[model samples]
Target: MKLFTCTHCGQLLYFENSQCEKCHYPLGFEPKQLQLFPLVAEADGRTYRLFGTTQPNAPTYTYCRNHADGVCNWLVPAESATQFCTACALNRTIPNLSEPEHRLRWWKLEIAKHRLVYSLLRMGLPVVSKFEDPEHGLQFDFLADASQDGGQKVMTGHDNGLITINIAEADDIEREMARKSMAEVYRTLLGHFRHEVGHYYWDQLIDNTPHLTEFRALFGDEQDDYGQALQRHYDQGAPNDWSQHFISSYASSHPWEDWAETWAHYLHILDTLQTAHAFGLSVNPAAAPAELGLQAAITEEPYEISDFNRIMQLWLPLTFTMNSLNRSMGQPDPYPFIIMPEVVDKMAFIHKVCQQAGSSAKAAC
Candidate 1:
């Protein structure tokens, strides 16, 4: 979420900006350059702008064919044959854009997906779409079957590195129904991306890593029956002591559920805390339930990052305030999930994984 500039006019800009206000130059996000830069277009259809153009060709200019089609924000290297750019290249499947409104929804979905990728990239996680490496590379397909009243029913979840999201997630009513069905606190396009990516990284960061045993110790043996756990969860409901052992009632389903739920919350907390800091709210306090601040944090920096102590310190009070605010608005609590101390420890593990990946990506950069 760093500041970007207009490649042509040097206008201060945002990641989502489509046009530069000051210079009127078109703006886009270049994945390879990893910056918001300007573009130069020729009538023949090839479009590009110099890499670090304002700073001289630090690297060769990158091009995005989507820039021509007006769908993508990323840029690929000059020598790169891929037209979609690294981020867009990750798409295993997208909804049919022939319907027009589908394109708009698909556009919004891509924006959320890119934001998820940005956060993961910020944390240094590997994001290989299933297309990049069907055997081992992680990726997603934002597929929609016939889920709406008229559309086909598409499944939403992760499998063998592919995550299919019902395009109906873009439709308000369907999303709300699914949220109620799952009994989730926070359900959003971004949250889905984070949760599914968590599944992907379950392999990349934990299952494949040297700390596999430690992961098993914290989350318990993932070898336990998964499908059966879900069946039992739906049949018997969560245990009476769910609050004591699980963050969400759903987490009581299984270890994998526990992991994904915690992972999603970890992202939520970090992002919310970042927003808080950017808005100048209090950060990780020393004690629980500090005086609530209505304002967001002045400058976001995850205080306890990968450490349990600070996250707990910050989370307890912040969550309380979040709930209170929702109550004031007459809406359900924004974060219905809870995190026990043991769960806090697991979240710390996720922070560590993200930090390690971030370190690797930064070093390579």
Candidate 2:
């Protein structure tokens, strides 16, 4: 995510911030502009104009309906007929908010979902909601397990275009326990969103398209029985040399999973590189030996760079700096996984797919 600051006071703000802490001015993210504008309420009490613009022709916007529940900070133009913003419109089911705990869980899921949508928009990928295209449009279902309510245990996965997330994944303790049990190097709500959406995009951008042949060549044939693959993985675990060919042990379960895991990492790299570029971050430790090749910089947006090698050049050094900082603070590495050449080859394929999708969208527009 790009760094944001309040226009009124330049106070650094999080993507979820509803108001500038320093100026106390209300804020709302305008998706088209990719900006969190300080808002000035209209006298009619229905819409808000941007903070400093006085022209009568200036556009006005209103918060998404989810804003009333403090789950969204995105805005839709006042002229728009829809009540939900691009991100919030993806919701097909939200946990019952009458239960106090459910409210927090829903909010947490929304934060990650909103960020996921932001990345999708940044990549110029399609963001149609299930309401727009019931058959294949993206949607989310935040559900509780049978242990919490009276339904079957909810699994975090994707089916067609609908992504189901167990509300328990939002709980830190539960997520940590699952991570340890699975022996995952890293896991988070955002990671889950990115991974599942990868599946949705596979259905949209690759399935039955010309790209499918190349995808099969790169990620292996996804036609293998997915359930059997996962069952074998759980029973016997990954191959001893899994890292030589896969991004993670779970990724070794199936061709589809390998693609999804690589896709998630691709988004991870793009977002983190964007954040670094936003902050003008670079690694050039003066005292470090020159032979280590530690000097690096992010001179431009990762998404704009078509060269996968350039993205990795900046990514590896940034991870080194980030991991060092985390270790210094006695915390786990922010980027715990390695990007071997084989994994990079897979990621490069994802980069090409995303680039093509972006170009196709632009051409249609």
Candidate 3:
């Protein structure tokens, strides 16, 4: 979520930008280097070199096949034989794009998916596609509900390593209606991606691993009947004091949900704090009480920081500022949930788990 710049004209660019507006230079993201570069297409029309590179040995790259439709901006090294970049390669099924609406929805989904993948890559977590390891590799299924065609509704959930999202979630009006009906404070495509991927990572990094026992202790025994738990939750709602222990009311439904909700918020904190750091943002209210914690200086990238406390130190102030800004604009708070002691404990566990996974990846490398 950090800010990006076009290498050619220094124009500020968003992660999804395919071209620099100011200089009209074509822009592409190099995921391996976590950088946005202006591309200099070769005469052969199949390869590109990075802008401003005078070295004869500069690496060349090709766009992912998904880039043809403007749904992706990631670059794949020319030496690689894969037609897709690291992020787009995970797709198992994309919505039928013959329909105009599905095309727009799929494009939106890709933006959120790419952002999610960017965070995973930054954490040094594995990004294997289902094609690479059919049993447990990550994959996406962007599907539309078939109710109109007399089939079952496509639910947005994760199974094994496959994450299926109902394409309707990409539509703002439909998503807003769902948020209101579910009585949720926040519901977004990005949140859904983060939460579901948490389940996939649980399978990869924690299940049957040494961390399972600790996870059970913190999240309660996930062995509890999941189906019955969810049915009971829908029938009898979350406890009145659910906020004291869970990140969201839905999180109280099951131990697995609690982990996923907490994991999503952990990601929320990291990405938001990184954006704040990029802007050199700090909060220091001269008239505010010291105990209010209305002051913090974001001096380090939250993703690079190992300590959970330091992450919170930057996150709390930034959320306060974000909420205040929204209020000033007569809009709802961008972040509405509160983080109590128990929720913090859950998030701390997630932080530790990610650190362990990252270290394992590093050691193997």
C-alpha lDDT of all candidate models, in order = 0.71, 0.91, 0.91
Model 3: runs farther than 4 Å from truth?
Answer: 147-150
Q: How well is each residue in 184-295 modelled by candidate 3, as lDDT tens digits?
A: 9999999999999999998887799998998888889999999999999999999999999899999999999999999999999999888888988879978889899879
What digit string (tens of lDDT, one per residue) describes model 2 on residues 1-365? 99998888889999999999899999999998888989999988989998989998999999999999999989999999899999998999999888889999899999999999999999999999989999979999999887545668888999999999999999999999999998888999999999999999999988999988988887889999999999999999999999999999899889899999999999999999999999999899888886876778788999899989889988878898999999999999999988899899889988988898899998999
**Model 1 scores what on Cα lDDT?**
0.71
**RMSD of each candidate?**
3.9, 1.5, 1.2
Q: List the pairs of residues colliding in candidate 2.
A: none
Clashing pairs in 3: none
- What TM-score do all the candidates reach, one by one? 0.83, 0.97, 0.97
Residue 67 CA displacement from its true place in model 3, Å: 1.1
Evaluation by TM-score, superior candidate among 1 and 2 = 2
| Model 1: per-residue Cα lDDT over 1-365, one tens digit each | 55576756777786777678897766667664456776664334455565345444444444556555456667666666676666677777777777776787787788778777776666666767656677877666667666468876677788867778877787767788988887766578878777877787787777867878887888888898999989999999999998887678877788888888789888888867765654556534445343553222434367336565665666666777878778999988887766777888888887877787778787987
